[model samples]
Target: MKNLKALLAVPAAFGAVLAVSGNAVAAESLVEENLVESVAVESVAVEAADTVEAADVMVAEPIQLAQVTSVSELSDVRASDWAFTALQRLVEEYGCLEGYPDRTFRGNRAMTRYEFAAGLNACLDVVIQLIGGGDLTDVRRLQEEFAAELATIRGRTDLLEADVAELEANQFSTTTKLRGQVDAHLVVPFGEADGEVPLLDDDGNQATDPDGTPLTTRDTLEEADATFEYRARLNFDTSFTGEDRLRLRLQASDSASSLVNAGGLASQSGRRNGFEDNIGLDDVYYSFPIGNRISGIIAANSIVTDDFVTSTIVPYDGPAVADVSGPVFYDQFAGGNFGAGVNFAFTDNLVLDLGYSSEASNVNTDDGGIFEEYSYIAQLNFLTDGLFNAAVTYIDGESDELDTPDYTIAGLLNLDFGRVEVGGHYAYSPSDDGDQDSYGLGVTVPDLFGAGNQLGLYGTILPDDEDEPLVVEAYYQLGLNEYFSITPAVIYADNDSGDDSENIYGALRATFNF
Candidate 1:
């Protein structure tokens, strides 16, 4: 009876050995199947019969087993289980046993003979290596009994390694990633005033009509029709040092014209509606760290004031459809140009930003050079641990197109209260004609209906000495999914010029991102 009991404890002793060995590579390849457990029990009985009194051998019922890489991967194996430490030592420490591919250990299930053999064989291999091949007679007997199953497990492991190697060889770029966006717009304009308004040249001076009469806004709006336009952009972002980025963006669009003319407030016409159906390089820039707290950007093309500032502080800056998108005074000195900028962090919450840009930096003509039409901007940004954040900015520039020297100071602020946010900005630009002021207030409610859905309301007074147009916009963006969204917006503009030149526009935009 004593010998019979010792034979019965053989499997348990082998399980204990498995607990001491380290992680196993073969265990990950074990197959999930059930077979007679008597095969293993009978072998133990025959092997131990000569050394002890004869006894009956008990056969465990066949049961399902799974393969797992680590004990933690098994959902049923918890720290509180009585055998948790043993299982952890075998699977995590020695890799002698693994869980199912579906992350289950099925600890309550009975084990089949093949499963026991596989585990015992895996631990015996480790034991022999540790003991320098001086294993006892019983260990050698067990290895011979399970040799076939062990060979099968080893074969599966080799296949898994090959697959991993193939995947790594066929992987995509290691240092660069591609992202893209497409925006489609449908614009419908109504309530256009009758009678012609004088058309202004690029310099804001009145231009004569073909018949020598003054050209007017009526000539443009009367010919305007509801239109559909689209813009597509593909961005390739590459990183060389893990922290620095080089970005190249290719863009194409067919939205160069506006539906409504807001006197001189060009922002009221919308910023995204000007690509002229041409494909070109929209932006190219390289940004890198200069020091522990300083970062710099060198833009070969398409640089703007927002590139220099840390935050614009306006909630509608990306979604709004009119002047409310940003403070109008920013447009006074900050258009797309070639430039460079730097950000210096004074503290965790405070930063100083400076930038320089020139309109004709890429031109080779006598009248065109980096210094011919240039701007300098400085901004102080404040970010708090609380809900409020703000920035103050100053810009100095000269534009030969508008034939004026630009000097402007601006302040931006935002207060976020989780689902609800309020933002506003004020910009003042002093010109020889008069000091121009532009300001706007906006409110946003995010996740109004569901995740990714938003509602925004905005009102702004554009920076025009003659018109001082007031533009109001409301929009709701409905996110259908992570990669697609639709927005419907209504915009109204009325100028102090008081020609009853008020106009209303309805727009729908569909956006796809990937």
Candidate 2:
């Protein structure tokens, strides 16, 4: 062992030299690198040899000796302590100091000279490694070699630490998760059709006044240029219980639809576009499970009609599809409103759902109307989530213009073939004046263009025997990235206003999700 006195002589003398020269003081900064050898040799025979002994040194168990990564692990090393930074440096940066069995330094307790000397020896070893091979000349060599590079690295590390601190200080909600979607549509429609008095597929009666004659108009639809607009929705989803979700969706839409391309007179557009740009909070709902099989949802401002077991059996209803979604009058009951619904699972694959909604409930009778618009619906669903699925739906609809409830029964089904999926829905809509039937059929070729790419052909028939409202929509959807996609589609409508004239429409739909 080199004498402790000798090990200390070089560092003490070098410190004196650094003290005299500003450059040396700055250059001798990293003790871990420049003084490593001398620090290790300091446990030699003199300065600490008589003060500390091997038996007095701390011998920690394997668990207690775990490499300390956090300051919290040292029970007695409070941040408020005057020497806390030094303590942390010695424990973490140098890894030269170890705590007692209780994982604490016990700073308030007294210690023997031998214990103090042992700890000092620990620190000297770290210093020896820091100064490089226990030789002061190594410190000078390192200073000359990487002074600028180390300084730059240190500066960047400090900046990063500050950024993290700032971010943690001014953050948003802890319990709420934010999600959003945006859809932009470029629509070009061509055609103007003369309006006509229409009949139904079932030799149905016509819409008429109190008299026996039908009501008819000869209005002509006006043609326009390509229009571009967008719909955006921001959702804040919060969960009080792990199984329950509260969703608040803020939405904006300004685009309006023509009677032709936007599904003609069909209630549900087979060519589903996205939301129009009406900027406001559009949907607020809470869904919770009562048991493993029962689920429920309630809306405060807006809701989806087919919110439970009866999802609108159309692929275009999804964000992945370019077409507009949801049944127009059916989902909103003619307007966005408050509603409640429940779903009961009969088996793993079968579910039953019921709901009631009304837009006029929020309005005052004196101001506008109360109970003016409402619908109560029930649906039975059977699913395999693979080859076949079906739903039978019944809706009792009422409005200020209607004398009684309009009864409608809708059946929707989806079937899958190896690489193709086929789905359709048929609704028997009967009113006091007439009986109508609306139907849709679609075939989707998955991976036809590429993996996750789809080519879909869809058609909708709005029951009007005279001026049959028929729409055929075809689209190729391709995803460019995880959160973005583009779809180019064409729509052909046989009648825009129950007239003989036909119109063709083109659309480019782009969607982004966050």
Write candidate 2's Cα lDDT for 1-514 as tens digits: 3344445434433322221111111122222233444446566464254223321221221122444555578787789997677656555555555555455665665554334445555556555665557855665887889989999999999999999888778756656788988777777867765554332110011334344454333355454567666667789999888788899877765433443334422211211122233366666889899899999988876554565445676654452222323332243233335688899998988889998776554666432443556667888888776888888888775655432326778888888785988888887776666665677788888777667678888777765323446777788888887798888888777754434567677777788889
Ten-residue stretch with the least lDDT total in model 2:
17-26
Model 1 whole-model lDDT (C-alpha atoms): 0.68
Best by TM-score: 1
Extract clashing residue pairs from model 1: 21-94, 22-93, 22-94, 24-95, 67-99, 68-98, 68-99, 197-216, 199-215
Residue 236, candidate 2: Cα error in Å is 1.6
Q: Give per-residue CA lDDT, model 1, range 396-487, as digits (tens).
A: 98775452435888999999899899999998877777778888999999889999888999888877666687888899989999999988
Q: Write down the TM-score of every candidate.
A: 0.63, 0.58
The TM-score of predicted model 2 comes to: 0.58
